[model samples]
Target chain A: MKTTDNASASLAEQSNDEYSVRITGFWSGRSELIVPALVFILAGFLTYGTATMKVMGTSVPGPQFFPTIVCVLLFLMAIIHTIQILRTRRFPHEDSEGQNADFSTDLLSDLADTENEAIYVPTARPSVTGKRKAYSDWKTLGMVAGAVAAFILALPVLGWILSAAGLFWVVCRALGSKRPLFDLSVAILFSSAIQLAFNAGLGLNLPSGFLEGLI
Target chain B: MESLSLLMEGFSQALTPMNLLWVVIGAVLGTAVGVLPGLGSAMAVALLLPITFSLEPTAAFIMFAGVYFGGLFGDSTSGILLNTPGNSSAIASTFEGHRMALDGRAAKALATAAMGAFIGGLIATTVVVFFAPVLVKMATAFGPAEYFALAVFAFLAISSVVSDSVVKGLMSLGLGLVLALVGVDGPSGTARYTLGMPELFDGMSIVVITVGLLALGEVLHIASRIHRDETAVRVESKGRPRLDLSDIRRAMPAWLRGTAFGVPFGVIPAGGSEVPTFMAYGLEKKLAARNGDTDFGTTGSIRGVAAPEAAANATAGTAMGALLALGLPTSATAAIMLAAFQQYGMQPGPLLFERSGPMVWTLLASLFIGLVILLVLNMQFAVLWAKLLLIPRHYLYAGITVLSVLGVYAISSSIVDLWILLGVGLLGFMMRRYKFPLAPVLIAVILGPLAETELRRALTVSQGDLSILIDSPVTIVLYGLLAITLVITGIQHLRHSKTARSQALKFDTDKLGV
Candidate 1:
């Protein structure tokens, strides 16, 4: 029972870190300080915007009333968040969980061990010599975002089906699908099916673009 | 009695074969979307809002009602099998539902969740049927000041109470309100932050914001990590799916208790299903201790799953009542539904029933129908949904990406909206990556406009008297609740920090072999 409890606890931890970007150095946790800083900058911008808004009436609340209030609130909250982040250990690396030094352990192993009691028993790895941060797969995130951008750029010229098919392939490749042939087939079939349903069946006009005359 | 007769008439209208088919379609679609991680009823409703524009209000709302309940039902399936509860409401179920799956009682756990949801949802809908009129009557008495105060109360409650860090939550709330302020002010006719765009004249599209933040953001988040690990498998259980007599006996009272936790929260703008679910789980845990049952927090507890599932569905049901009766949206899903009501060019306050009586009653009746359909579908096909977890993560997320793009593009048929979707999706990704809560942002966006309008109207009525905000009894009561909430949260925070300190000390001692 203790083992199960600990294993489940670790599973919760794993899930929490599922999409987190890893960092190194003694200031690893300090990366969290960036969000509060960004929020503070945004609050300043809102404040400036509110201050410049022309008030139409003298008696009633102006258009800037709510925005100004929210801006001030955000400014104060961001400051408080900064203070809190500074006071506490800000990074996952600083956590006392036994595996902080070894960032190369396969995530799938952690998942497979979710069902096993052995996960509760932490294995000690030698403290690493250099700063080895296993940041979340940013390359895939970039590729996916790029794919969406490409779709946006392509849609007006290439139309819905073609752009959407291209999007599907790009996303599939980013998600680590190994078979390009299968990916192409799936993307074509899926986009065409959507075209048939929404465009043909629902009578909604999807942008035909260059395919306006083609099948 | 009048309500009962009206409800019966509503049943007559809704029970037609055509509406039944709509309900079936909605339930199936809602369940399919809801089973996917990171997509809840809010996203489902938002993505489908364009359809509402083309359909009759009654049929559109019936479909939405099905989606609402079906989302809650389907969320627990993924929570049980995949350990990924998409929404806060499903978090409590993960506590013991996943444990039960690991304990080889997956079928029993699923049954408990399904039946509990049905009982709680049915009872809560009955509450709505009886109490909506009363709520409508009460809502009629609310002045602008009272409305403003209620919005403030909601904003404060969600920002300070829902999340671990009050600062982060308030930041999220602030950002949402800022987003809400982007369009031309409805009263003043001045553009606040349109950045010289005609599309910005109408403000950000809620559907675009919602689909981008939730659906696309989630897809991006998952894509970032999908290649690092293989997809996890669903836990297999040995027993038949049917709940035994003993199981039902244990779950029945807990279901009622969970409903008790949920009903009052429905009235309050305390955000979403998360609070009631945690409350139910805690209550059941204490009850288990009282009953000398030590199985909780370890292997599994049936009441653990039953109570939270009931609480979640009960909250979903009563939230609809509040939305329909008072025009208050307490959760993200309800907020989207509120947006839907707005899309129909109707405000859902005291005058809604009077202005659209038939539509409102039919919607209520369809909710009941949706509930029954959800129960049947969930019970019979839950195992089939567990199979959904077996789909490769890449394909699942790739499909979501397509859906997000399609939904956004379909709504406005504009590339500009797609651009907004991508930008907001990235913002959502960053927010999630930073552990900032998303619900506060959503709630603020939905409620911010109302808050501003009501405040301005109140001040205008009083000719700039600040005391007008406190003049009414309703406003006073709401402010009082806000104060009490703050005090309680402060105490809780203090207690939590103390416990954490002690735990840290114990850890230090253990490290030193003390």
Candidate 2:
């Protein structure tokens, strides 16, 4: 449904101006490098950390030995993984499979469970691409993350029942619950039920927070 | 004879009302976890670890046994009903199980799976009762060098064999080893990589690592794909899940064969039940083809569901044997179980059989009891369990998220654990997104310190001579096996990828021909 002329015009501009292109809505083709980079930096930190550790005795293998081996392995493995990502041409811009570049083609899902099947036959594009939506629901993800953060911060003060109820309600809303009023009630009922079960059956003390006297 | 008598005593202890109640609770909880997508028994055990502080060690372990086996049984329920295998072990069964459901024989497929699991678990546990003592004897002869080599073998086997890409697997393992280094070193009094935080000095808790990686990580992964992925349709199961005469006859033989295939892999630490289940499925498919049984890849065959289901539970049962005898965890669930044992201040090794004879036997006995209970639950209530999938997606995940946080917080009442849980949860989500295997990271976290401690001890004993690592016959044989296994598995991996590549080529070429 995209015009090739417009896509090509943007493509030309993209080549001239150095900018990041998303491989998929969920993941960028270039973002695969992050794990290797993180691993490399961790190895660097560990190497420095190992260097500072004083060997308590004249022991042959000190506390640093295992850590040194671990960091080295991390470094080597990171290098290998980076090389792998570099070798795989994620953007087969002119590949034989599909001459037309479909912006909405989710490469990850396409490759998944079809290792033994050819890359999408050019004939199959309309069916696959038509049904799919641009994924990576970052809004829902943000809501979930925010709810967890709020719950953790407020747990001690608001008490387990109230905070947990709040968390459940927000997460339900984030996950696509339309009825907030109904969701909150269900959340509170379940959360308080959990509190009573633990308090009565297990005798494990959860923080009562401000509800200490009331509960 | 001795173990049999000991097992009888175990039955007596396990048969008590209180212990039986705990077993029921564990089984029910474990089955619910196993049936739920994106959750595993390892996470259930991790969540349960905190409340165990108030539990008797015997009751706790009996419950852990129930949870472990219950997970294997319940994993396949989702596979048959929804084509979404709850665990990796259930993947192979989904090939035929879901097809059978689609063919309007859902009850038969479910029955076949339950029977397969029952027979496999029974035979495997029987083997474990007799065989674990011999394993413990062999374990007694193992010195520090042997244990270190075993851990290395575990690390190598898990990393290389389980994942599609070896590099990512090792990267996951490296992440775990780095975390393992956070606490005070055992050989030397040096605190390492702790970043000078007092909380980090105790290192990462196994419970936190497991829950974050397996549970919360899954929630985030689901979040990212919530809009894109459509909900899977439930194959409405009709009729009572009881096999007719013909169905039973076909499944009985396949179950035995699958158990045979599974028994050996259960002892090896090459990840979890996935491999054996896959292999068993492949074998059954080949055999069915040879026999001119045209049911596969279409309406599905009952034997197809039976074989993989058997292999999965058999692998799980014998994994418990390995955990008890050698203190070696052959799977992620077993690894968490080892952590559970440590929580009770009990180390499961050669000495555990002698010292905690009653506890070990009771756990083993309860497994048999739990297996019977599971057989009933899965067969009769097959449709009932399938109804769990209908609990609306938002509510299921939201509840899991809260439970993950609540479980971790309840353990220590520490805000620091919650913070670590959050960070690890993010890492877990990323790892899942990138397709790095989660089990190796878990296996490495639990086994890293043990491996390191043994390595140091061996070197100290040998006065820093590297030759001592391969000096003993056991150590030499273990390394030899490791070398041979790596070479063979490497060849197999190359062959598999080549086939995959060529098959893709053929599919494209055939489309052109048409």
Candidate 3:
């Protein structure tokens, strides 16, 4: 037990060092402001552009007016915050020597080094040398995205039951469920119970799709 | 005497078999969800909201109260056993609790936490029973402008104080306000941000946003980390947990201290249990240190577990008072309960106290009863709850996601609603990832219309006299409290930054082998 504990502790220590290096490499002070700012800008522009359209009737204000104001505010705030972050140049906690690593210069130097050091490209899998994988687990992301897409596409035609079951199965499988039959049954039971509870028990009119008459 | 008589009448109503059954069911379900990591009372209530449409107002509220109290009990179980807090309030409990578990005193820790919860909950409920009438009298005197100011206070206090960064918190609030701006303009009937979608005329349902953001968003976040090799270590207990006379004596002081810390914070508009729990823990730690009980970190200090647990439960009761009396929810769970009240067309405010005095009194009475129920239940079932950790994460989160999607669709039968859920889910994910607080966004959306309508109505009534806002003593006090809270929070932030810098320097010195 002691030996195993020691081995696990060493492994964890090594992984912690790797994680810290990676996090410090990517998560610069400016990146925090830059990423959120870009997202807000994109979302703000979309909201503003959509709000600009005309809608009939009630003359209180156009549909776009409030959203436009919000978008403009968001854009202005993001820009101001980003500029403030840039002016600070470095986080408060960094060592003076570390602060001298200009962010843009570091990025450019790293890219150039990578280009020079290019060799036999590694496959996107666990290495035979037993090194840990460097890339994200894309399969899990795909599974979640697929489940969402299936629900959106199937909800209209296949209705709640089929679409819900499909989404649940996809997600469960992604999470490492191997018992397809048992998991599927569990999903169906849950979905049916919810549907009945809302429709019959609560007097809600949930969609029945093609099975509307049969139910 | 009149209030007592009214409460007796309320007990007569609440004691009915149907209401009793609903409360029990709600409590059981609430505890179950609360015990599950990442599943909270807010998500539970939000999921059950569609089903509440058919129930009577009194019964629905009874069930909601049961769920709220049950969550308080349930969250502590996770904190004590796994060190993964089911709620933010339980985070402080984990510091001492996980230490106790490591010391092979898990059962003792669990027992003390349960006892402390009962004591705190009982005291808080009694305070509510006695003090709610006075609060109602004060709350009733406020006009539209005062209410509007109160709403602004709630928004700013929650956004700035609850989150790690004020900017991100304000950004989340701005996002929520933008979402609330959708649908028709109430004053002029003009479409705002609906984008020609007739289905959005009623605006996005709070239910959809809540379920998508909290339940579905959590499912996604959990999935992202599922394949990670790291898992929590489980401790095996040698025997059943029992409380000795010494344990009881040690815990009693901490319970009282925690209650003192919790009740006032709960009454405030911030509506979070974290502050009270931390304050209680800090106080206990200081007292223990002064008494030369620095060994509390090694040997399980009953005070360490008791204080945070008591604060967690005590805050639950005070939060209810804030909700029922002020119609303002300080937490996500409270927000969902507010939605449930609205669903039954029963607004919770000063009028509620006047019109439903008996009901409110009985509800307060049931809290005392609920505390007893939770204590009995937790003591008997601590082991059973610990076993829940063995359940596969995949099955649990997947099931929650499926239920959320179905619940949203069932509410309105609109595909547009599903789209809104997806959109909100993405927004919630981003907010969580970026450390932006989600509670303020929900509060802003829930109260946005009320603020706007009240502001407009007050202006018309005052004939554009802005001084009408501060015309009443009540409004003046409310604004005064808001100003003090802002100043205090700013000072606290400055202190925190200074402490963090010193701590960082200490770490650097240690790293240099000095």
Best by DockQ: 2
Candidate with the larger DockQ of 1 and 3:
1
Q: Is the docking of candidate 3 incorrect, acceptable, medium or high quality?
A: incorrect
Q: What is the C-alpha RMSD of each candidate to the true structure, in Å?
A: 6.7, 6.3, 9.1
Ranking by TM-score: 2, 1, 3
Q: Return the candidate ranking by lDDT, descending.
A: 2, 1, 3
lDDT of 1 by residue, A1-215 (tens): 01133332343355542222222243544667778878878888777777777655554678877787888788888888877766544433212221211111122122112222221121232123333334357899999999999999999999888999899998988988888899899998998898888866666777878999896
Residue pairs clashing, model 2: none
For candidate 2, write residues B324-356 as lDDT tens digits.
Answer: 999999888899999999878888889899899
Clash count for each candidate, listed in order shown: 2, 0, 2
The candidate, 1 or 2, that scores higher on lDDT is 2
TM-score for all models, in order of appearance: 0.89, 0.90, 0.85
Candidate 2 lDDT, A95-120, residue by residue in tens: 12211111111221121222333222
CAPRI-style docking class of model 2 based on DockQ: acceptable
Residues B1-514, candidate 3: write the lDDT tens digits: 6656766677777788888787788788778887887788888888888767677777777887788888878877777777666676676676678778878888888888888888888888777776777778878887898888888888777777555556666666677777777777677576666667899888889899889878887776566556743455667644666898988887888899999988887777664777677778777777887899964767667788899889878888887887888887766677788887777677889998878777787787666666777787777777777777788888888888887887787687777888888778866655554445788778878887787677667766777677887887777887898888778766766665576557645543333234
lDDT (CA) for every model shown? 0.78, 0.79, 0.70
Candidate 1 chain B has its poorest 10 consecutive residues by lDDT at: B505-514
Q: Cα lDDT for residue A73, model 3? A: 55
lDDT of 1 by residue, B78-121 (tens): 77876666455676777789888888888888888888888888
Which 10 consecutive residues of model 2 chain A have the lowest summed lDDT? Answer: A98-107
- Give the interface RMSD of each candidate: 10.2, 8.2, 13.8
